[model samples]
Every structure is written in C-alpha cells, then in structure tokens.
Target: MDDYQRLVVAQFFESLPNLSPELCHQFVLRHIVPALLPKTTSKVDVQPSAFQGSMSYTAILHIHSTHGGHRIVVQFRTEKQDLSGVTEASCIHGSIVPLVTYQGMYEELFVYTSPFAEGTPYISVLTSSDDFELPLWKKMAIVMDLADLVTRGARANNVPPDTAIVELTTTLDKTQHAVNDYAFQNISVRTSISACVSYVLSQLHNIVTLPLTLTHQDLSPFNYLIDLSTGNVKAVLDWDGALYLPVGSNFHFLDSLFGFMTLKGWQDADDRHELEAAFYDRALDSLAAQGYKGITKEKLELQKAIGMLLYGVERLLKSKDEHSEHYLDGYLRGLSFMKEPISSSY
Candidate 1:
C-alpha cells in the first residue's frame, strides 16, 4: 500500500477501533474460510483494496484449494454509512443484483461479501463497444428491470413518504442555493441558468407528488453491468445510497442507454434516435401490468422532466472543475423544456 492507500485504510478502521488487520485475518480464517470453503483447509489470500465506494471500505478475498478457487468481494460500512433498507434489495432485484452470500458485523463495522459477478460495467461497454451499436432493446431491458424494482420494491422497507419528500425537498433547495452560487460566480450563464432552475423549482410539486419508490441514489455507468452480446442487464451494483423517492427519480440515467453525454450535452446514439417516448410507454405499461395503476402519460412526462432537471443540476454542483463545468453546460443547454413552464395540478 502507498501513502494514500495507508491513509484510506487508517481512516476506515477509525470507527472500528477494535478491528485491526490482524483481527480481520483471523476472522476470515476461522469464520469466512470455513463458511465459504467448508472443512477443507485452503490457502486464504486477503487483499485489502484501495477500491472503496461512496459507502464502504472494500476488500478482495481469494481462496484457493484442490477443489478450485473462489473470489469474493468484502465491504465494511463506515460509521455514517446507512444501508437501512437494502437487505431485501437483492431478493427484490433478483439475479440482476449482486448476490450477497454472507454478511455480519464486527467491532461495529457492517461487513458483507458477494461472490464476484462476471461482467463489465455498463460504462465500459458503452466506452468500448464497436460502431455505436447500442440497440434500443438493451435500453428497454434496463427500464424493464427498473419497473420491476419499482413495483416489487414498492413501499416495502422504504422511508415514510412524507419524510422522504422532505429530504428530497431539502436536496432541491440545496441545489437552488448552489445554482445561485454558481451563477453569482459565472455571470455568463447566470440569467439563462437561473431562469431554467426557477422554472423547475416552480413546477417541483408535480415531481414530489408522484408514486414513491426506492431511488438508486447513484445511477452512473460505474454502478451497473451490461452483457456485451445481447446488451441486457448483467447486474446492478452498489445499492449503498438507495433512498425512497418519487418514481422517475432514477430516470435521468435511462438517457445514457439511448444517448451519450459529451462536453456539449446528450448526443443521441446512431446520430438521431431519442427514445424517451418509447421508454415512458414501456415503463408505464410495465407498471400497469404489475397492478401499479394510475400512472398517466402526463405524470410520466413530468417525472422525466423533473428528474432530469434535478439530476443535471446535481451534476453541475458536484462538478469538480471547469472541465466538468463545460460538459454540464452543454447538457443543461439541451434541456430546452426546462426554460418552458409547466401547468402544475399538484
């Protein structure tokens, strides 16, 4: 481990004061090895990684023996990390989610493991796949899985709707402040960005009042997997910051399937095919088929708009530097509808 790696590990074990590397080693030998490999003794290789996600300290375990080899991923939650309603998520999401074969706590750290799922992250697929051949069905498959996540994971183990709305409202308000700050610093985009945000905020109630579901907080390419051949979903990874919010909160990511984001905004794949209407039709139909009725086309349009607006602003605020700012500027510029007002019935 380098200096930064040492620092990362040191920071992680701060909360687990009683959990040293030695303890983790022994625990793996006594508990994990037996549980995973059974009575036969195996050469256990515990590799502590610098690969920590937004919520946990992660490590890799390689167990080799006469039978075979097993590679497992281990994660220890930080003190502030809250995976409050995620225990049932795997079962809810089925094989499309990483399977957690083991989980337990030690020295106040929430630790768990999943047998490594074999597939490339969706980001990699998009980045390397040939000739921009990302088909529409792959995008639809992801949306279908999302519909399943929404209907099956409905309200179960979710935060109270009112409370969830309050939290979401706080986030929107914070973004409003951030936008104001950004506009104050960069006067060039001030008026246009401000007006767009104002339009979104003015129509925000339409977004908050829709059906509530577990919103995957981070819906980036890095968090999901796609098959290279059929382009279907392989697995959805890292449910750490999952929260309860109105449907379509995660819809912003659905665009990446049919389009690619450049420094200049969302450019449609294969040049001119924007599939938003197709997605909404499939999603609404899926919801109705699953007995989650009452979703009108009007509501879904508003959901997509509000979700995209909220997410775009979030990326703008979370942008680390001017390179990111340029990319965001292009993305926001393409959202011409945000500048147009919506008739709110909420």
Candidate 2:
C-alpha cells in the first residue's frame, strides 16, 4: 500500500475500533468485491479511481482475502497530515451506534428491523470500527425491500386509490413545515413563495387522516435500487433515519425514486411514452387495497416539512462544535422546494 492507501486503511480501522483484521477482511471479501468486480467468463476489466478530497484521495483496492468466502474491496486513501491524524484519533474514542438500534417489531417497521437480526445480507462500511453504521448498499437494500412489503401489505388490506395521493400530499406538507420552523428557529433563511407553500399544504390538508405506517425519513437515489432482471426493486438503503410517521411518510420513497429517475435523465419523451398514469394508478390502488387510509396532502406535506427541519437541525447541532455550516445550505434548499405548488408530482 502507498502512503495514501495506508492512511485510508488506518483511518477506517481506527474509526471502527471494534473491527478486527478478520472482520475487515471478511467485509472486503463479501461486499466490496462483488459489486465492483462481478463474475467474468474471461479476463475481467477493472478501473481504479480515487474518491476526491481536498488533501487526500481514497483508492479502491481489490484483494482476495482469506477470512471471507469471496473477494473484498479495500478503499485506501491519505489525508492531510494535520487533519488525518486528528480525524483518526477522534474515531478511536467516539461511541458507535449499531444498526440494531433501529430494529423493532411492527407491521411496517417490522419488515425493516427484522432483516438486520435475521441475517439480512448487506454490505456495510466499517466505520467507527463498529458492527454498526451500515454501508450504503446494504441500507438501500433494506429500504427497498421494506417499501415493496408495504405496498404489498396495503393491497392485501384493501387500500384505496385516494390513499396514495393523500399520503403523497401530506408528506410534502410535513417536509415543508419542518424546514420552515427549523430555519426560523436556528437560521435566517426564508422562502420566496409563501402562498405556494400554503396552497400545496391546503390541497393535502383537506385529505382525511389515515393509519400510521413505516416511512424512511431520508429517501433518495442513493437510498434505492431497481433490479433489472425482475423489474422489481432490489433494495432501499438508509434506514438509520427511518421512522414510523403518518401514512404520507411512506411516499418519501416515491420522491426518491422520482429523483433518481429524473437525475439519470430517464424522463425523456420516449420514456414517458412507456410510462402511463396506470403505472402509478395501479400502485396507488394497491396501497389502498391494502387498507391504507389516505392522509390529506396538507398533513403529509407538513410532516415532511417537520422531518426536514429536524434533520437539518440535527446536522447543524452536531456540527456546531466544529463550526461547520455544511448543512445550512441544504436546509435552506429543502425549505425552498417545499413551498412550491402541490399539483407538482413527486
């Protein structure tokens, strides 16, 4: 390993102090190897790139490990001499939270929590050298699976079409309010269109309240996956921030899916031709069939607003010690997006 690689490995291990060399080796073999390096009948082509950083670069290492059954990936990089050492030292002393903390028993949350203890196979980044803090891939898988389960369950319960529309609306409202409240309390950021937010909020609020369900608080492209083979969702990542809120909360996953599709530039005229209202209508009907009482768009949007604000506050408060303003911009952006028209789709 070069100086950079050595530093990267050292920092990873230092963060995850509980990680023995054996476990680290296993992780590399089991997870990293599979994604970056898939089965090749002939010679395999491998490209190496470094994770960008101001003072350090992280390189991917493909090494066959003896501890695990398969190959593994070891990401190695170096940091600024001054910052790297300080950063590693912090990990050595910091307390770590296992993914287990998110586990629980419930119809909605159960699908998510059960997987962890049940050997829900996943790849995790060995941060804090602890067996917690899941890697992106594993987290994504869990959320996607839970989303599917929720959809299926809704259908089984005889949910109605309006339920999904209501939930989606409600979620947007919650998110907007959360962002506004947090910004006013902790920062000076304000939205330009107050009426837009109100209009959207009102559209959703008129919808009736429904039973609570499981919703991933933070859903984005990085959080989900779609299996090409089965045309089914392979996984939904990032459950650390998962919560059991109103029915609208469930729509958070949809926004993530839409965002992913949109970002990939998949929303072309041709793609739209393949997609019809039926695609969404059927899914929404399924949720209603599953017995979901639709939440008004207003309620869901408010909840989403609140959720965003809480998350923003969390980032600011946590980083206050370091005087980091990293998430402030994001907080403001999230609020701005919330105060928009409700007729806008996810």
Model 1, range 1-346, lDDT digits (tens) per residue? 5565567677767766778766775676667767766866667788775344444666778878787887787766654344554555676777777755436776576777786766666766665566445666766666565545544555422455466557756766776677777743345454555555555555554555566677777777777776766656677777766777667667656555556666554465652234556556767776676666777655555555556657666666676456545544444454536435534443
The residue pairs in collision within model 1 are none
lDDT of 1: 0.62
Q: After best superposition, candidate 1 residue 344: deviation in angstroms?
A: 7.7
Q: Write the per-residue lDDT of candidate 2 for residues 1-346, one digit (tens) a residue.
A: 3465456545555654564335533544454446445773223222222222222222233333354323211322222122232233223212111121121222111211111111211221222224333334433444444444434422122345378556656655665565555434324333522444455445443433444444455554433334432334444433443433544444433332221222222221222212322233444555566665453334444544444444544555555522223333333233334435445433
Quantify all predictions' global Cα lDDT against the true fold.
Answer: 0.62, 0.37
Candidate 2 Cα outliers beyond 4 Å, as residue runs: 1-11, 14-189, 192-208, 218-225, 236-242, 260-283, 292-346
Model 2 scores what on Cα lDDT?
0.37
Clashes of each: 0, 57
